[model samples]
Target: MKPYLMIALCCGLYAGLVAAVEPITVAWRDKAPYHYRENGIEQGFLLRRAKHIFALAEVPAVFVERPSKRIWRDFERGKSSYCSIGWYRLAERERIAQFSVPFHVDPPHMLLVSPGARATVQAHKGVATLLQDGRISVGVVDGVSYGPALDRLIAGSANQVERVTVAPASLMQMVAANRMDYMFADEADWEYLRRHEEGLDAIVEQRFADMPAGLERYIVCSKDVPAQVMTRINRAIGALSDAAPGD
Candidate 1:
C-alpha cells in the first residue's frame, strides 16, 4: 500500500473504534429549571448544557430519568460508563465518583416558609438564629446536601427536622401544607414552582443574610468511567462559554 493510503486506512480504523464505544448513561432527577420532564419530553437548562457538552466532545450519551437516590447508588456500585448531571462537588461524593469541571452555579438557597410559620421565620434576622430555634421545624430531603455551610448548621442545630425522600416540588407542597415550618430551596426552583405550581402562594419565600454563596454544580460519573472519556467531557465543559439559548 502507498504511504498516504496506509495513513488514511489507520485513521479510518481509529475513527471506527471511537464510534464503537458504548454510550454513557446520563442520569437526572426531577428538578425544574435544572433537569425535569415536561409533557413527556426532557427539558431544563442543565439538561440542554449536558447535551451540548457531550455533542462537543463527540461522545455518545443517553440521558435517563432516575431517582436521585438511585443515581448515587449506581455511582457507589462503580457502574461503568454512568454519569449524572448537576451534582454538587463534595468530599464524600468525590470518594464515590469523578467530577468534571464545574459547569453550573446556583444562587444561594432561601427558606420556603409555611404560612403558619411565616411570623416565626421572619422574626429571625439570620438563618443560624432560625435554625437554632427549637420551636421551629425544618423539612429536608434525605441524602441531599444544602451546600456544606447549611449542612453543618443543620447538623449542629437543636431544631426538629423532618427528612423525606421526595422531589423538591412535592417538598414545597409539604411546606404549603404546614407539615414543616420551612425548607431550604434554590431561588431558581422557587421561581419555577411559583409559576407552575398552584398553592405555592401559601409558602412564603424568604432569604437569609447568613446564607452561603452559591455552590457550583458539576457532572459526576461513576469511578469506573474511563479517564479519557472524563477528559473529553471536561474539555467540552471548559470550551463552552454560554450554554443557554434565547427563547
Candidate 2:
C-alpha cells in the first residue's frame, strides 16, 4: 500500500472506533422522588444518580419520558439505548437487557387496598380471591413486570380483576375512587401520592410479600450494550454511595 493510503486507512479506523462508542438514552418514568419532571427539566434522585453514572462512563446522555411499560418495551426492542434508572432483575429480562448491580435501592412495594375493601386484603391469600369476589380490582401498568407470584396471579385470573394500565398518578386515582381494589407500588410512590392527590386518604397500604426478585429495580441496559458499559455504571454508582449529596 502507498504511504498516503496507509495514513488514510489508520484515520478511518480511528473514526470507526469513535463512532462505535455508544451514548445511552435513559428512559424516565415519572415516579416522584425517584424520577419526575419539573419546570421542563427532568430531575429526581435515581435520575440524578444515573446522570452521575453516565458522566463516569464517559457517555453522552438523553432522557426519554414515557409510561413505564412503553419504556420497557422500547428498551427491549432497542428503540432506545437505556432503560429507566431502577428496576428489578428478571431472568427473562436478562435475555433481552443487561442490568447493573443495584445503582439505587428502593423500598419494597406494598399492596394498597381501597379502605372499603380492607377486609378483602389478606396477608397470605391469593390475589385472585379478592378479584373473584367482584369487590376488588388490581391496578398495574400494562407491561410492567411484577415477579412470578403476581405474574401467575394476573395470568391465571387477570380477566377477573379490573385492570388499568396507566401512569402512577392514575393508579392512585383509581384506588381513591374504589375503582381499583389493589395496587402494588413502591412505598415511596404512595407517599408521594398522598401528598399530592386528595382523597388518597380513603386508601390503605399493606405489605404483603417481599417483592419478587425481578421486580426489584436496577439499571437495565439494551442487550447489545457492552458489559464494559455496565461495569462503568456500577463503579459510578459505587462512587455515588461515597459521594456527598449534590456532589
Candidate 3:
C-alpha cells in the first residue's frame, strides 16, 4: 500500500473505533407531568432532566416507553441503566439503587376526597376511624409502588380500611361514583388528572394545606451501575438545581 493510503486507513479505523460505542438507553412511562409523550416526543420535567443528565455526561441516550411497574422491575432486575425520578430515599431502596442528588423537593402530597367525605374522615382521627365510621372506601392505583409510608398504612390498617385498586385514570371514576371515598397521590399527578380528564375538576376536593412535606424526587439507577456514572449524574443534577422550577 502507498504510505499516504496507509495513514488514511489508520485514521479512518481510529474514527470508527470512537464511533462504535453504544448510547445508553433510558426508560420512561406515560404518566403525565413526569414522563410522557407529547407530539411524538418524550417530554416532561423529569424527562427533560434525564436528557440533560445524559448531555452532561456526554453520553448519547435513547428514551423508550415501559409501564411504570415494568420499569421499576427492570431496574430491580438490573435489566436497564435508567429509572425515573425517585420521590424519596427509603432505607430499603437505598440498598438496591444508587440515587443522584435530589433535584426537586415536591410539595406536600395532596389528599383528594369525594365531596362531603373530608370532614367526616378527618374527624375520626385515623384511616380505620374514617373507614369504619364513615364507611369510606380508600383507593390506591393498581400496580403503583407504595413507599414505606403507605406500606405501613396498609399493614396496620388493611382490615379496617376498604382498599380498592383502580387504574390511575379510573381512580377518579371510582371516587366520583362514591365507590371510593378518597384518592391520594402526588399533587402533580392530581393536577395532571384535572387537566386531562374533564368533569374531574368538580368531583374531587383537594386538601393541600394540611399535608406533610413531600418526598424529594431524584434520578436513580441500580446500585450495581458504575460509581462514575452515578457521580456524573449527581454532579449534573447539582449543576441543574438553579434551573429547576419552583415548587
Question: Mind giving the per-residue lDDT tens digits that candidate 2 earns over 31-88?
Answer: 7878888788887777877777788767677767777778777866776456567777
Model 1 deviation from native, Cα RMSD in Å: 3.8
lDDT of 1 by residue, 1-247 (tens): 9999999999999998875677998999888888888899999988998999999998899999998889998888888889999988889999989999998888889889999999999999999888889999999988889989889999998789899998788999999999999999999888988899888888888998789899999999988777888899999887785544331
Clash totals for all models, in order?
A: 0, 5, 0
Q: Where is model 2 more than 4 Å wrong at Cα?
A: 20-22, 67-70, 79-84, 120-137, 153-160, 208-215, 242-247
lDDT of each: 0.89, 0.71, 0.66
Clashing pairs in 1: none
TM-score of each: 0.87, 0.77, 0.77
- Across residues 75-133, which tens digit of lDDT does each residue of candidate 3 receive? 66776455555446777567667777887777765566767566655665544344344
Ranking by TM-score: 1, 3, 2
Query: Can you tell me which runs of candidate 3 are displaced by over 4 Å?
Result: 1-21, 80-83, 86-88, 116-119, 122-134, 158-165, 206-210, 244-247
lDDT of 1: 0.89
Q: 193, model 3: CA deviation in Å? A: 1.3
Worst 10-residue stretch by lDDT in candidate 2? 208-217
